[model samples]
Target: MPEAVAVDPVCVAGVDGCKAGWVAVFRWVGSNRASEVQIFPHFADLLASEHEPRKIAVDMPIGLPQRIGSNGRGPEKAVRPLLGMRQSTVFSIPARAAIYCEDYREACSAALAHSTPPKKVSKQAFHIFPKIREIDQLMTPELETRVYEVHPEVAFWRLNGQEPIAIPKKVKGSSYPAGLDARRDLLVQFGFVANFLDQKPPKGAARDDLMDAAVNAVIAERLLNGDAEPFPTDFGRDERGLRMAIWA
Candidate 1:
């Protein structure tokens, strides 16, 4: 690993997990252009990279609870209804113990023990547990000030004048062109160039992944400017003091 170089105070990033690793889109604050789109095999590398942004809005869960309530966490509960049809994009995260488990059955068992009403971990949420753990292991209270948990659908809802987007980005595990186009249009309305939005995503990330990352970057800028708000007006913190709110 290389030493982290001088930070770009004006830069902010939007990141999402991808098949290869984490795909990040870096943009300068107040600029419409995305400076770069790249992938890191590990989350830690992005933190150590030369382009380390002042704020990062990533499409992943940041805070983990010791025990969960009805809707997973406060943030998920607050934002789910706001998404309407797109709410399915948000998954209810289980407890930290469940997330740390190595096997699906073990995770479900742990989740049942940790959550109220004894819910099992969903396969979709379980699939991303490793990525969640990756961020959890490296995250600290101070780091929480810079890295924020964001959901792309939630961000889009906020961007779309607080109305839920009617289109699903994917259907039956396949990309939907109309849905992608709708999101792209929203991105353009928010100052992203259509040219950059249409460019091929870097190897290992899908087009929707890139677009999700781009919207996250937009929210990062909003957060930097004090223009963004958390899902739960009053947020929660885990045992380690990591913030448990999703910003948009």
Candidate 2:
């Protein structure tokens, strides 16, 4: 790889899994392009190898939003409602909404009965209250903090171009209309810009593909709309520093 470029406030992605494991970094090029500039195997590696990112907009929920209870006990509860749980954001995506409900439900069930893939305890109970109580009871602040989660659906939109929601016929009620092609374009755009920031592309050039565009969206949001939270210059001491930069 060539010498790393000078992109500030790089956009990053971190995943936890066997094959599906990677952290992507991005930066903006000129006015028309954003790219997935860099790829790392893990967050630790990224932190150690690359510069400190300005604002890492993850693909997972940072907070579960303290739940509210009818009684007066501070906030109701801070639990991720079963999968398919819905949140009313200005830019809501049906597919994402449905997944929240489904994912939380599945995650909740797994927590209950000790191990996941719950036994055939009771079909009716599973449908009704089922595993929610257990899930609600289990979610703690520490666990939430330790875990890295962001709604890919939201990231997809922010990175792709912040398209409007228009559910598809098949996934009409709880699905997104944006297809693979559009998503790919967005990713590629992000990758190019990210590479530009890093000043060098990856070996295979596969990892940076989506991140480049994602990072661009992040920077675009910052410069155009001032959406992201700003980090101080001191935040850049250890790492490469945030990917924030002035392209246009």
Each model's backbone clash number: 0, 52
Off by over 4 Å in 2: 1-20, 28-37, 64-150, 156-178, 185-225, 229-248
Q: lDDT score of model 2?
A: 0.32
* C-alpha lDDT values of all predictions: 0.91, 0.32
List model 1 lDDT by residue over 25-101, tens digit each: 88896544456789999999999879768899999999899999876799999999999888888898999999999
**Residue 219, candidate 1: C-alpha displacement in angstroms:** 0.3
Question: For candidate 1, what is the TM-score?
Answer: 0.94
TM-score of each: 0.94, 0.37
Number of the predicted model whose TM-score against the real structure is largest:
1
Inter-residue clash pairs, candidate 1: none
Per-residue lDDT tens digits for candidate 2, residues 106-218, read 53443333322322223322332322322223334443322223333344444545442232211333323244334444555544432343343355333233433344345
Span of 10 residues, lowest total lDDT, candidate 2: 71-80
**lDDT for residue 169 in candidate 1, whole number 0-100:** 91
